[model samples]
Target: MKMKSRFDRNFDIINYTLLGILLFIVMYPLYFVIIASISDPNMVNAGKTLLWPRGITFEGYAKILEYKEIMVGYKNSIIYTFVGTIINLVVLIPASFALSRKELVGRKLFSALCLIAMYFSGGVVPLYLLIKNLGMFDTIWALVLPGAFSIYNMIICRSFFVGNVSEDLYESVKIDGGGYMRFFFSIVLPLSKAIIAVMCLYHALGHWNGYLSVLYYMRDPDKYNLQLILKNLTESISTKTLASEGMSTDYLADMQKLNEMVKFSTILIAALPMIILYPFVQKYFVTGVMIGSVKG
Candidate 1:
């Protein structure tokens, strides 16, 4: 074993100190949000809910639960995200794998078209018109179908296939009298777990957080996803809390605290799924992204 010199020891100390500081800087906001969500909003606003929660309460969660639309929105969002991610994976994985093959006819042309579409698109007006013509406007299909697969993600998955999957394997499968379909289903997918995990995470996050499509195409309130619903609910809560006149000062103060608490709670609600999801796929994330990005 090599013994570290004084310079090496000093360097190690400095490096760990910097890393600890950086970790604190990155993590503090999330911690604060968590503490603030459960703490008395008055204490939070008064700058006293820094390291730990004070006057912890579940009232903010209770307030959110009182609204029935929030539950409906949660269900809708879950359905959209689940269905949309499945569509994305089904389209993206096969397309990416096909594109990674050199033997595919019109590969260059297809790749060129994808790149063009990724960089340029007919603006919102044309898309809206197309959706209307297809009779998909204000429909569930409107939320999940239009942007089912992302070209950029496809490129990444394709790169991953090219980099990680050996061409010799395909040749061996062909030698065994197995065709492309057999090779793809039985071989490619099982071996491409890292890239698949990465793509799933990416697409799931996109669908979960997405609201612009809902905002543009959805008109029926019941069909609204969680993001839009939460946004509107927050606004409605804020308006009712502040705009009501002739309420007692004590009542107003309580409403104000509830308003602040509601804000933090809603944020946590919106973000909780993604936060829970990331840890499960984290082991694959770095490997997939780095290898896919560096190769092809």
Candidate 2:
């Protein structure tokens, strides 16, 4: 018994060591970015700032906030993320539940169609033309509608339904004279917290980081999402044309560093809300994804 206990202790030590290494590998890059964002741009550019910041400055954050465009972009992104996630959930959850129901009429055909869309898409030009024809160009709907349904998320949710929601529960509900809507809302949805959380995280991140779709659909700069605005700002900084726009030499010099810092900082800021919230949601994702991936 004493030998077996020693073996278990050794195993635990090895396991913890491996876990610590993995954690460091994942965390170091993010830490490096944070430190670099606060350090002098020249230090960062010269690759001197890695583990710790040098010439620490909040000017980078200040410059990014001073831009009206960046502010507007933040507002637009928030609007898009909120509205888009709601639309996604509204469409995805019901669609997934419907798809999971074998008795639903034409279920197989609909599932096949959705799956086909995952592998093949109408080319970008065609999609752009369609959006233009639909008169959604330069509109917030242009960003929101095109991505309201993600087939991958739908499948994950459907799989969760198949695995976690036993048919016996549905049958029992039906025996009590419950219809699909009644059972779905009161029973299935309530029991699907984990999968729903996973879907929310997936959809929220997609909408938050999404910009190329907006770039294609939105022509007006006023309508630019956060990512697009940041892209433009980074471009302006890199090309050094920002100085030509009447910024003082001090501001310009600082702007150069500010630009570099903002580049990394905004990414950190943009991702921070979700990252902070993820731990709460992450507990659900593993179980959710696992259950969702299972066969009925």
Candidate 3:
């Protein structure tokens, strides 16, 4: 190992110090939220719950668990995310592979048209009308089908295919009496694990966090996804806190405290899925993003 000079040692110390500070800056808020969610909200509001829980309680969690619709929302959100991501991959991967092929006629035109559509839309009104006409409104199809595939993701996948995938492999497959479908499933997909994982993560996050489509298309509360339900729950808490005119003072105070705790708890609940899922795919994410973006 090379021995560090005095100045080099000083530089290393400074670099580590700065990195440590940056880590704390990024992580502290999330840490604070975790503690706040369990702490007594009165202590949190009073700034007494800063490093640890002052009066630790799972009441916020208990309160949220009492809501029966949470399970329903979880089910609906899971279905939507799972189905939507599958639709995205089913459409995205094959289409991107096709575009990556030099043999595809008018490929440039097709790419250009896709880019145009990505930049432009017919706007929400026309899309809503179309969905209504197709009898997809108020249905799960309305949530998952409209934006099933993203052109930007397609571009990345195509770039990966063009740059990372070799022509020799295609030629070999062709000589072995294999068509595009065989080549795609047997060769391309197996080799494109990194990019595929990245796409799955991206699409899954989008589907899991999305609530705007539900707002626009869903008419029934039973069809609501988890994020939307949490959003409504937050709003309901705020409303109750604000409309405490006739309530006893002690009751009003309890509502206000519950409101604060619920806010933190809901945020954790809403984010927990992605947080758990990301670590599993994180190794492939950075590599895929870099290669896919740089290629083509």
Candidate 4:
């Protein structure tokens, strides 16, 4: 390749400088949280810790880990995210694939129904009553089943199938003595990894971040997901700080600082899974989003 002119190099330098600043702006809050979680809560509360950790200590994390509900909450959250995402795909992918087929009878009608339902929902009270009547209340099914197949994801998957998957290949599969099942399992699905990854990320993030559904349907603390448990724990910080047994000024100040520090610790713990998961599927995620959005 020919070497760039001086103007091109100058423009490239300016672009990279702006991008670096933008990257830091987006990432600094996360970096601060990681450092703050391990730093002395008192120093954080005093605004003495900036750009670096101050009076580093692991006390906040140790306390959080020792809490009995923390592990249980983690277990439940993991189960919900994994199992829920699987079921969501099982329902969503097939429906989308079927709707994507121009040869299918009544496809348009079904697609219209999906679009209509996507735009409307029954009120929350009715939904709650239905869940209770079905005996899914306080159960894993309650969390996983309701809203399992999102019409939005279904539409994206259908678009991927229509725009990316070749109609001629599908017809050729039929000529080779294959049916819908064979084509889906052997051909279409194998070619649809990008969309699948995007759907999985969406559904997993929904389940992982879910707390309102748990609060509404499940009254038992033992059944609570991680988000709900951590939300409760974080809310209790004020109460605990105020209820500190010591009357000394130093003791009260320390309690306040510790509570603030623990907030960052809890957030870090809750977000760590998605942060780890994103990198593996990021390429497919970008491809799927672009194809599903900008393509037919």
Backbone clashes, candidate 4: 0
Q: After the best TM-score superposition of candidate 4, give how far the Cα of residue 55 lies from its true spot, in angstroms.
A: 1.5
Q: What is the C-alpha lDDT of each candidate?
A: 0.88, 0.84, 0.90, 0.87
Model 4 per-residue lDDT tens digits across residues 1-296: 99999999999999999999999999999998988898887778777777899998888888778878988999999998889999999999998999999989999899899989888889899999999999998899999998898998888888888887898888999999999999999999999887888888889888999899999999889999999999899878877876777688888876776678778889898899879977896787777668767644
* lDDT score, candidate 4, position 89: 96
Each candidate structure's TM-score, on Cα atoms with residue i matched to residue i, is: 0.92, 0.85, 0.94, 0.91
The better-scoring model by lDDT among 1 and 2 is 1
Report the lDDT tens digits of candidate 2 across residue range 40-101. Answer: 88989998887789888877777767889877888899899999999999999999999989
lDDT of 1 by residue, 111-225 (tens): 9999999999999999999998999977889988889878988888888888778989999999999999999999999998878878888887888898999999999999899
Which candidate's lDDT is highest? 3
Residue pairs with backbone overlap in model 3: none
TM-score for candidate 2: 0.85
Q: What's the C-alpha lDDT at position 186 in model 4?
A: 94
Prediction 2 global C-alpha lDDT: 0.84
Candidate ranking under lDDT, highest first, comes to 3, 1, 4, 2
TM-score of 4: 0.91
